[model samples]
Target: MALQILLQLIVTGLAWGSVYALIALGFVLIFKATDIFNFAQPELMMLGAYLSFTLITALKLPFLPAFLVTLVLMTVISSLLEMMVIRPLVGEPVLAVIMVTLGLANVIRGMTGLIWGYEELQFPKPFSAQPIMLFGAAINQAEIFTILATALLLVVFFIFFKYSRAGLSMRATAEDTSTAFLMGINVKRVFTASWAIASVVATIAGVLLATFTYLEPIMGHAGLKALPALILGGMDSVVGAILGGLIIGVAENLAGFYLEQYLGGGINEITAYVIVLIVMMVRPYGLFGTKEIERV
Candidate 1:
């Protein structure tokens, strides 16, 4: 019985970890391209899920078409956000940009509540409502699909970043914005594209999360939880984000299972933060982040 419970917890942790990875990826992608830590990413993701839910449940649209439409709309919304809020902050201090994003997150959360109401809404599952059994443990089809889909999306993004022309432009911009501009790269356009891509990624993550949990105005706050993954994986590494998420997920599950008996309630929520604190104390740059040198 003990072994079976442990196995089940591991599987559940992995599935939830994948969702965290997807959300963390959005934060890493936008930060990599623009050097701005977007606190609004979680809210953006929540908005995406809500929008998708509205399309499927309220408008009575089919899943396939609704998914595509939601992606496109998220892309547009992200781009517009970049233009209106982020673009003007070019060359501004990092603190200023971060503060702006914090405000943006609050604005998004309030706006979503105002528009959609504070009620918890149910989201339709993209897959059939069946549980898949593996090695004496069972997980819902939606959980399995969400994990697989997030992995596939990460692969696609990896390929795009490595092989595509636009991907090269994005990298170049990240390397040195002024130098990229000198080489005729449209820095503004790249920033817009980064934000758009981040939004789309967040939207997908949100949809997946809504599959397992209730959807509400507060759903976006989950993005804040992803900060631990970002810190663990390094802010600039997308691959690190995925790995960090998995580590955090597994660790949380294990703690909940093993330590809950001693620690009582809510240990799961604090597990990631505790891990981050330890990691920072040991290695501030994270697992994959480049070491920084400071000069007096």
Candidate 2:
């Protein structure tokens, strides 16, 4: 019985963690390309989910078509945002740019609330609700899908970054914008592509998350939960983000199950943050992050 409970928690946690990984990847991708920590990522995820909900429920589109359309729409929106809102701030102070991102987050949140209302809505499930038994643990089909989707995207992105021309250009730009431009890479286009890719990842994560949880303007708060993962994996490391997400997810589930009984019911809610705090103290750069030193 004890073993079964542990297995269940592990499986469930992985699913949740995979969603975190996807969202955190969005953070890493944009930062890698533009050196900007986008505080609006979560809100972007929320917007994507809301857009999906509208497409599926109101527009009566099929799941695959709706999903594809949502990706396209998100890509376009992110690119446009990069061009209009972020481009002007290119030479501005980092703090000022960050403030803009926070402002952008609020703008997205407010617009979502005005359009969708504050009432919680049920997101249409793309997969069956049936529980799949895996080694005596019952996992929701949607959860399984989330895991698979994350894996698939990871593989796709790995190939993209490893071999594709655009991917190589983005990588070069990430390494050094000045050098990349000297090499004839279009730095501006790379920035736009980075934002577009991040938006697509956010959309997938948001849609997967809403399948299991209630959809609301506040749903983007879940992105905050991924912050631990981002910090744990290293703010700038893609692989670190994935592993950090899984670790946080499993830790949260384990904490909820065993520690919650002794502490309180909300232990899981704060578990990731607590762990991140500890990690920050021990290794400020994160487990997989590279430490930088400045000679001043």
- What is the per-residue lDDT of model 2 for residues 124-162, given as tens digits with 9 covering 90 to 100? 888788888888878788888888888999999999999
Kindly list the per-residue Cα lDDT of model 1 for residues 1-296, writing each as its tens digit: 67777877887788778878888988998898898999999999999999999999988999878888999999999899999998899889999999999999999999999998999987887777777777767767777777788889988988998999999999999889989999999988999999999999999989888988879999876776688988999888888899998888888989988998999978988999999999999989998777889999
What residue runs in model 1 are displaced by over 4 Å at the alpha carbon?
A: none
- Checking candidate 2 for backbone clashes, the offending pairs are none
| TM per prediction | 0.96, 0.98
Regions of model 2 farther than 4 Å from truth:
none
Per-candidate count of clashing residue pairs (backbone under 3 Å):
0, 0
Q: Mind sharing the TM-score for model 2?
A: 0.98
Candidate lDDT values, in order:
0.88, 0.93
Q: Which pairs of residues have clashing backbones in candidate 1?
A: none
Per-residue lDDT, model 1, residue 243, is 92
